[model samples]
Target: MQITGYKSQGVAAAVDLVNAVTTVEGDASFAALREILRVNGFFWHEFEERDAEPLRRWGRTLREFFDAAELETAVSLLNELMLELPMHPHLADHDPHGLHLHFAPPTARLPHRFRASTLMQLSELVVQHGLGRTGTCAAEGCDRVYADTSRAGRRRFCSEACANRTNVAAFRARRRTPRTPEGTG
Candidate 1:
């Protein structure tokens, strides 16, 4: 729940995977998937062709949490996955992230490791913050999702581009609206 830096990687990797597989413009190709793992500090080298279907399917399934509109709905989905996944929680020490918890068993394959980590981290996030820290992007036409693991956790959009676009649109809308004179009814 107190995850920070790379220690909070599962949250980020979940977001990335969800976006990659769920967004219309996303690249869910094999290479793209591998890059996502590498960028998120997962074991990209171990990724196999056999892992693709499950990982892609997991992304589709995990997107439900981000799309959930109620705490009960999100909690139910996460709980179901938690019960299904085979988790073996243990401590690990490694570069770029020091000591932290690893949820998957040591012998688990890359995709299963990903699923366990993401599922546990997401469960922890929901437990700590309910639905406040993850959601679909607020931009008008974006389908991407996001998870906010930062201390402030004030995020609402998935990216700065969407944020800036929305802000600029709002500014233009406000400027276009004719304001009544001061004190006018």
Candidate 2:
């Protein structure tokens, strides 16, 4: 895939993974982690007993990207992460999807790979599209994070359901508004 395609995919996967970690209840079990990794195109192997902590830390860092108060703040946070958790970039074709760039070394641990790839991709995305592309849902009572990949870059909600619900609520509120006493004025 093209670099932009790869970056977009990575941002999407990162968002999904972060959201799952933050929104999902219960402890981060091996099965849950495996499922999240699988959905994000990461191959899951037999996880070590201590793997959950690193994954949680990674998720916390990823969540910070979305929770940033402004674009510059988000960029700064990402840069700080890049400096703290460096990734050794090297070419590899381990996947059947064909040759693509890999950020971490082949022997890196799963948490390291997850952190490196997602953070690198997120940095590229922010550099290419600005930190405004990442945001929380605008719908009431829904704070899910989403990567705004639309061409127009006007996305406001995390999902269509939230958008629809917000719209419907607004329409109902407008209809219920009282407008009268014009002639008395």
Candidate 3:
């Protein structure tokens, strides 16, 4: 399934938050959190000091969602969140991105809006591609998560660095292992 930039940002933002909160201990500082929002189109000015801890906690919750081993488990988690978060989905023509779906009403607090956006984006992802587009990083010792937003959907690592690190390790390991004689039975 093709993922538009509109859907991808929220999902990518969720992944970024999860990695910030989980992959690096003590990394989800307010400034760092605000930058995540800015990078994802949430706008740093929209961020409040009060929003940090909640976004951190939400990041942890989303990590659980990405870590789920079964479709039923992931769906159940999302359903529980949907029951809790207020979502007022509507059409909007907004600055930057024009004519797109807005998951939260304009009056909602930024944290609430962030929650609503990430939740609905994830729900849409599950609907379109199940668990195929999200995963834990394949690199050993890495706890980061990733959401594949590209049309190819072939991603297995959270970043290009992780991909290169893992690939280099695999290549070196193969080179070090003794190859059996071609005629050996």
Candidate 4:
């Protein structure tokens, strides 16, 4: 389903947070993260000399800290926790872009803004659809989470690549496993 700029930002921000946690133990470069953040309109351009403090001070390797298992646990927690946040209108024109709510203004410290905006978005979703809609990718070995905006509610992977890879792996595993004779243990 289609979403507006404000709604998209909320989803993008949540996806970004999920990306940070999921990539904690896997191979996802900052550029890749940037791309994902931008997917639904959460911009992450490189500023020549913008104060790096807020961005860097987040301290830990956001992605590398949460393993796949931990990432799943976090998704569940976030899904529930996000329900408690309130969506207040903090609309403003910060960029050359048109008017929009800050949700959590971009000018704020990167980490704080990210967390607040993301939570706001998830909170919005929770109020609208409840916790059953937001979820982690169903594919094993993938910790990616999506807001599941699909009309049919059938999304299972963060992307087609993960879905295809998972299916292929399953097919190979079945081929490799030894088969027993009929009625044999």
Q: Evaluate residue 120 in candidate 1 and report its C-alpha lDDT on the 0 to 100 scale.
A: 85
User: For every model shown, what is its TM-score relative to the native structure?
Assistant: 0.95, 0.85, 0.95, 0.56
lDDT of 4 at 132: 52
Q: What is the lDDT of candidate 3?
A: 0.88
lDDT of 3 by residue, 1-185 (tens): 34577778899889889999987543799999998999999857989898899999999899989998899999999999999987889898888788888889988889888999899888889898889889898999888899887778889998899999999999999999999999995
lDDT tens readout by residue for model 1, 73-119: 99999989989987889888977678888988779899999999988
Give the clashing residue pairs of candidate 1, or none.
none
For every candidate, C-alpha RMSD to the true structure in Å = 1.3, 2.7, 1.4, 6.1
Name the best candidate (by lDDT). Answer: 1
lDDT of each: 0.90, 0.77, 0.88, 0.54
lDDT of 1: 0.90
Clashing pairs in 3: none
lDDT of 1 at 9: 80
Model 2, total clashes: 0
Number of residue pairs clashing in candidate 3, backbone atoms closer than 3 angstroms, sequence gap of 3 or more or interchain: 0
RMSD of 4: 6.1
| Candidate 2 residue 9 C-alpha distance from true site, Å | 3.1
Q: Let me know the TM-score candidate 4 reaches against the reference structure.
A: 0.56
